[model samples]
Target: MAMDRELVTCTKGDGFWTRRILCTIRRLVRLSAKSSTVGNMAVLILSISCIDGNLLNAFYHAAPSSEIIRQSSMNSTISSVIFKDYDVTVMLFHSAYLVDIEQTEKGRVMKLDSLKNGDIWKTMDVLVFNSWLWWYRRGPKQPWDYLQYRSKIVKDMDRMFAYKMALRTWTRWVNSQVNATSTKIFFQGISPSHYNGSEWNEPGVTNCLREEQPVDGSTYPGGKPMAATVLRSALAPVRNKVQLLDITLLSQLRKDAHPSRYNGFKSMDCTHWCVPGLPDIWNQLLFASLFS
Candidate 1:
């Protein structure tokens, strides 16, 4: 069984595939168990298998404050479904940096040049990068003027530009990781928000997420056209090398899949999703894209 797992790890590319194979093996083992004791043994084996798997991957996930702070039902679901027990470190934030790249599966968040001679450029197996929801969450800045305020805390362009530059440098470094085959890169596309109060936009839906779930085919109105355009402008240069997961259109359609309705949150949240729902969808799409 250990040998088979090693082979699966090598051929299937580590974390995700190994977990899948182990899951199958566990179900089979459970079916063959003679008693409750055997079932417990099977469960232990399953846990150990996951712990020992050698799929070291990393996901540098970024999104706007709205997505993280508000906790989108879809986002939560996606994280739970796709990342459960996986050998992936999700550095989830609106922005961050790869300070020292030489730390070997453990790099600090310093300046970009600090990674100039580090080996993080070679050891990474997968790179999942993103940033967009932040801008949307904050709405838009004036053409010649910008404003950033967290209630009473307000920052100017210097801080915002520094944040953007740091993120860009981090992503550029991520793109430099070695072994393209061993490394599968992905980026989340723009997720259109529905705050405009337009007919299709569905105004006044404070926290749309709930457990009851709205229909799946309804779309949030009015954000994506410009949003995607801006996102494309930002990521287009790396598009060829990255698998852009455009989940916006489909996500918007799930009207009730927000924090309040679909997510675990009690209020009508607009950001995160229910773990079993949209996250599963994202993982399905992710797996298919990998194989197909």
Candidate 2:
């Protein structure tokens, strides 16, 4: 079989890169790496990533209107972070939606034409965002059942189109609310899964199970996913304002890195990566971009 969708988990990194990111963060907490502002600089990361063993958003199982903090079931410390030496406050939200929704006669509707959630990204010294992977949702897993676009309520729009509209709303907010002189912005690229072997030129294989080696070269045999193209095109309008951390191509070459069949209990979990592995590289790249 093949992985129809991603299976997000609560796995965490091994702390080598996570700690390194924090160390580097102390140096460049501000947009200009200014010592005066490093101690007080604030960063807001909107992603599905994990830190301290907590998933940022972990949306594949998230209930609708999950923006509300539970305060009981989850630990509060995960939402905000502060290091001993660095006084920066970093807030991580599992937010991919940057628009509003209204309850209409047609059920819940997401207004793709509006950015009602722009306030989430406003006034932060550094904003890092990742909004892919969840775009492929459907059936019980899909968060929104209806999408309101151009004044029309749609039962379902093309995933690519919906993804584009969501990013467009976010990029528009970045262009409008995020000032380049004050805030540094970054957008993570589409994350890839190794469900189908053909994508990496291994036609006989079915998944990442038992794989122990990377694709032998720099170029991924599968070329680029259509989502990657859409991601770049959507960011074109605000590219100057938001830096793109294009991790897809390099990640596509790591079919062997997924936590696929590490044990029989969760063998088919090919969508997410293994902890102490690929996420380190992703965070390394993210830190590099932050310094640049």
CA RMSD of each candidate after superposition: 14.9, 7.3
lDDT of 2 at 162: 84
What would the TM-scores of all predictions be?
Answer: 0.49, 0.79
Task: List the candidate 2 regions with Cα displacement exceeding 4 Å.
Answer: 1-16, 29-39, 50-78, 101-105, 263-267
Q: Please name the candidate that would achieve the greatest TM-score relative to the true structure.
A: 2
Which structure among the candidates has the greatest lDDT?
Answer: 2
Q: Taking the tens digit of each residue's C-alpha lDDT, what string does model 1 give over 1-292?
A: 6544434433332334435433433343344422234332221100001111212111112211122211224433212113233222222221212232122232222343334522532333334444544432332532112232222212334533434544455456656753444445666665544333352544564434332444334554444555555555556666666677778778766655544543234444555543334544554555455443
| TM-score, prediction 1 | 0.49
Judged by lDDT against the true structure, how good is candidate 2? 0.65
- lDDT on C-alpha atoms for all candidate structures: 0.40, 0.65
